[model samples]
Target: MGVRVIGPLDAAGLDVALAPFLNAQEPTAAPYVGALVDRGWVAPTDAGTYVLTQEGVETHAKLLERIQIQRAAVTAGLTDDDYRTLLDLLQRVSANVDAFASTLR
Candidate 1:
């Protein structure tokens, strides 16, 4: 997703390329991707590939970077508020995943 989403700006293609990375049975991923598009972060090109608008792309990059930093902080054994923050973020991320899944269904 990081790689595919950045280059060419194709969130749809990013999802296709990331199919193998998903935990869904039989490589399901479109629902989440479609939900993302439906949510307005990406727009489809006539060729069927979607690109993030300038604002979406920038915002997505910032979010991805923050998530990476958070994961790294957890992996590095951060504790106290850092640990709690990570846990909080994990809960939010889980909820988002669930919400996205609901859209797919």
Candidate 2:
């Protein structure tokens, strides 16, 4: 869970970048754009391209909370049985969601 800087992207591109970690979680992107802009984490470069600013690089580098959280969770009493069950459950739910989404497509 090393930190990676992401652009001041529009909602769609932001989703693509965050999808790996954001699965099953609803992320607030629109408001984040404004917030990030305000904080100077990102900046608009053109009509479509948004670049990760210097602030973003430092911020992400400084933040490893996600990595720490996973480390803490694994340090907890999480056995292999619990791990497998969680993975299986996630897969099953994802499969169902994918099937439903295909219908919409």
- Using lDDT, give the best candidate's number: 1
lDDT per residue as tens, model 1, 36-98:
678787777887676777777787889989998888865686766987898899879987997
User: Poorest 10 consecutive residues of model 2 by lDDT?
Assistant: 21-30
Give the poorly placed runs of model 1, Cα more than 4 Å off. 1-15, 23-26, 77-105
Candidate 2, overall lDDT? 0.71
The lDDT of model 1 is 0.71
Worst 10 residues of 1 by lDDT: 1-10
Report residue 74 deviation for candidate 1 (angstroms): 1.5
Model 1 error, position 12 (Å): 8.0
How many residue pairs collide in each prediction?
Answer: 0, 0
